[model samples]
Target: MTKFISICALVTSILLLTSGRPVKTYSELYRPQFHFSPEKNWMNDPDGLVYYEGEYHLFYQYNPKGNEWGYMHWGHAVSTDLVHWKNLPIAIYPDNNSTDKVKCTAWSGSAIVDKNNVTGLQEGSYKTLLAFYTSRGCGQRLAYSNDKGRTWKKYAGNPIIPEAPGEETRDPKVFWYKPGNHWVMVLYRMPGGDKAKEGISIYSSTDLAHWTFESHITGYYECPDLFTLPLDGDSAKMKWALLGGDGSYMLGDFDGKHFTPESGKKVLDYGQNFYAAQTWSNAPDGKRIQIAWMRESKYPGMPFTGQMSFPTELSLKSTPDGPRIFRTPVSEISSLYGKKMDKTDKNIIPGLKNYNLLKGIHNECVRITGVFDVKSSNMFGITVRKSRKEAGTEISYDVKKQLLTCIGSQMPLAPVNNKIKLDILVDRASIEIFANNGEKVITDNFTPAEQADDMELWTHGGELMVDSLEVHEIKSIWRE
Candidate 1:
């Protein structure tokens, strides 16, 4: 009995001492919508690629010390389902502290599992997991993880790809084109004097070591990745797609040498805040699940925070207009919903003469959905904040012009504009203004300090008919 008690006490002491301070995780504070944190500190661009061995390992550009995005360690956290994540330890930190070595950040990259060393033609799987990422100051580098991805070791004399002129070239993604029977690498590259569009470099690697530069995929920017999905829900009509910097998409075809998109138009995102996208073919299920760096641009440093839309499930759905990109929140977030609010006339527009009846939020995530058929004017949305005339934020999307706008502290992390009407979600420290459902969106970060609670609805010259509305308060550690 004495020995058992002593061991238990020692274990307790070790846990208490090792655990340190409970990480003040603001991930749950963002909103009932989508919580993001590839594990604390500061996470920017999401990277690394496999969904192998059951767990979905999502890595990102994280700084373990502070909230400001720096240091550039790849923070890793796995999800059984994509939502409801638990923050894990720092996966990859900058070990090379020398001047000759590329120091600063690990930038962005992709991970591929070379199990049979198919690229080696038969080199075996001693180091099956391969990571191709951009090194700060250098060009692109490679690293391999053998025992799953728990720990990683850099390749000897790396920099598989040398520096190009505009060093802006970054984000490497490798995909196997089965028909061609070769591995292809897609990376970001910008022409020397061209500030307009960034291009995707295509490299062919037969032995995974010796890579030959082929061609450019699309004119894009920032982190660019490419994949092919069914165009009309049929493999016969497949289009090569690239996820780019400005929350856009490139849809076309890759014929061994180059990427030829049907048009230069970006396929469109689920909303405003999502960008620097990377996608991989789903492992077991084969459903293409694409995750991106949902940037909360303005409110970079606040105790409470915000994030991108949930990891999206992408598909090409045929619409009356064309083969439109259809996306919905990954199934994981659905687990966060308890009891859903029923649609009712009370949820209607011009709601009972605007009496600020605060009952429940519209959607599951403390959201508010309202439809106003405005004859004229910018009075299409509302300001749900702590007050009516204070520094509180207002979220509105002009239906006429087709743009969503957010103003104030607890706004969504997206682009703000005054163009369209929307189903806006007033998250804890964020707002997800879904314009025309998922067709358009604008997420922006706001910094309202004192009055983070309460709600208000303001209109412009004309009146807004409340089509429907809801607000969901998720069970979170940082509830307003």
Candidate 2:
């Protein structure tokens, strides 16, 4: 019997050796090097972003079944530095065991740390992490987590805010309104058809379980977020900003119950891809950091369906366009910078190619900063991710037209003193351009050949002076 068992084990080992190393899946070819994406499946609209105990928790709309949108669940990930992420289990999901499965999927909402056990859901010494979400067939529901969000329990008296007839409401963004001494919720509501009114409905709650509708602000669409920013970095001059899902915002003043607009509709991003933007709750140092879903960008044959824009630090600035929002990449991104190259004060004539400007730079991932004196040239800018034959994306400024054209998308620019400054971040498949110190931002995705690693600077029609240009190779966040 012992000899027969030994022979069977030997045969199983031989078959395992012949099966060829467990078929490695999850390709990295077109995957983002820094952006957070699930290992496989669909993700969109960053939801429930909160900071707690030195960690940033990000919960996003996820379809765990496939690469397409369906059966929404809250996919979880945590980051200490916002550059590297550690994915956790699905934080919330539909109750599949229930007899009625269709009404069980969990939808978008916000999370808060119940430090004072306000909801009375605390178990033992763990501080309750309460999440408010929209459940199908139910308007709004409350869930609590005591094990640091590893598990969750839906409130027994759910559908806390019952669904109203003739109203299609979802996407509730809740926050702690300290002055009001209660929790505030900014919910999106669309009332029925043709004559339907679409806008934000404000509600207030005290214990994170019960809610009372306070007021409603119309003239906007879905995914409402309300926050305040200090104008020109002055706390005394602070103003409130109410944002919609489509990147349109209104400057206003919030008295914890109603929002009074000081300005009309204005756009935050003029790009095609940004959508469903959300800001982190309880950010450290009173920072207003935001991120948006980069929609409809081609990911080719990859397993994921969408990507998140680089996290940006938002500030209200007094520009010629009045109190406009300014966005810059988060400071934590600088930790990925590597070897650098600099070119200063060079005369670039028409039809001149500055090969040495990118002489030893052969990286697809880089951060390039350029300051150009646009006095002499009709058109001048840099081309990046080029092949040997110079096939790449061009970023140019037209002095005569007063425009900045990036791959055919033209943006009217009123340069201050005829000097244009650009900060471009190049990832494997996307480029984020910040012009005039984040006054204008354009994000676009491109597909380049595998060998397209060259770069060049060119001028058209006349001469131009390159005040300064610096390029720094960026390391992949996954390398750590």
Candidate 3:
């Protein structure tokens, strides 16, 4: 759903006129170096994420006409390594002759590979790529791509699931259930026009064309995703995760028709911007990789208004509290690593003011990995995107409060074994911090001052031991 327009949207539109096409050279200021963003206009919510035939397809909510939200269409892109992307034509669009009073935009949904020819829609040697999406006020719809997502055709029997009476339903996340030998669709619903009645509705289908209502559970809102993950890397100990649009999730058990809650709600990212995350369907090697919309970020004087977070691999690990989800950037990101620097066994003292560990190295796009032993320091952190004048953003941990703070957002994170490990990815406009080995994640956006590219490590009140620190400058995917 379109929440609110950014104040920067007005300025972005006045800066330049869009060509209504994807541009290869991403030279615009604040453009992400490695993140996936459309060349122009408004984009949000990663939809129809699926991997097939060595290509990963990324479809997102796009506004084609301007740098603001409206005229929703499914913008398409494909990547072999998930780091470099080639933009494609718009996959789906809103129906013009819709009879619904409200606009019929192609909203959020999921895609799957019909390897078994379940729908009998395959026309080539490769399996059919089936995408299920909501036609806004109308209902759930289906479209099929026979040419590996190069082209798409809407199903003849559109709106496979009719609109609900006195309600609105959207964002259908469909997956195959092996044990039950059928398909399960988890959809977000607003029953009786009541926000309090907002939750996820379950449906089952024997064939891809028709669906039957199975059950409804209250609590979740918008972009409901249901998938199974093995806990603690144990394939036999599997659990179902029901993720909501706001990055909150619940661990449970699913029997294809119904879901039984085993754990309460837990956050996936304690950041202000992360939202509407979706996993790749039919991913190879049993990997559950995810991408999310970095909502509410403003990109002034640029053609694009929103960007997607760096793709991450998800895993379920047993924690002291319970089984929680962990997210780390995928291994494929190493393809963009360049110009590395390393340091070990360095001491950070309180008197080391104006000291820069990254004195000679200054780059807008880089990765910082630091493992600091909280020896006797009450506060220790790193400052990135810094300049001689601007102090940049501080990513620090408070020992007494057990809180990790960055850019005014704080995550309650405790150090593991008295050592705080941080893997930070800094781009032109964003910073993604993965702390304590992905136990906590924060995604933040910022516009640095002119020439703000310095970095440093600091300690407060006492001394800190830096076990190891490594900085790797990232090569921009847009450039060669």
TM-score of each: 0.76, 0.90, 0.93
Instruction: Order the numbered candidates by TM-score, best leading.
Output: 3, 2, 1
Between prediction 1 and prediction 2, which has the larger lDDT? 2
Model 2, residue 105: distance off in Å is 2.4
TM-score comparison, 1 vs 2, better candidate = 2
Reference-based lDDT, each prediction: 0.60, 0.82, 0.89
For model 3, the stretches where C-alpha displacement exceeds 4 angstroms are: 1-25, 97-102, 353-355
Model 2, position 228: C-alpha lDDT score: 91
| Residues 1-480 of candidate 2: C-alpha lDDT, one tens digit per residue | 999999999999999898775323333566777766778888888888888878888899888888887688899988898888888999987653433434667777888888899878899787888888887656788888888777888888887898887667888899988889999999888766323478899999987778999998878777788999999999999999999988899998899999999999887876667788899887999999888887775777777777788899999999977898888999998898899999899877765454346655788888899888876788887788888775888877888988877754567777777788889988777778888888888876666667688887888887777889999888877765
Best by TM-score: 3
What is the lDDT for 113 in model 2?
86
On lDDT, the candidate that comes out on top is: 3
| CA-only RMSD, every prediction | 7.9, 6.4, 8.2
What is the alpha-carbon lDDT for the whole of candidate 3?
Answer: 0.89
lDDT of 1 by residue, 377-454 (tens): 454456555544454565655544544456532222222232233555445545555454454444554445444465
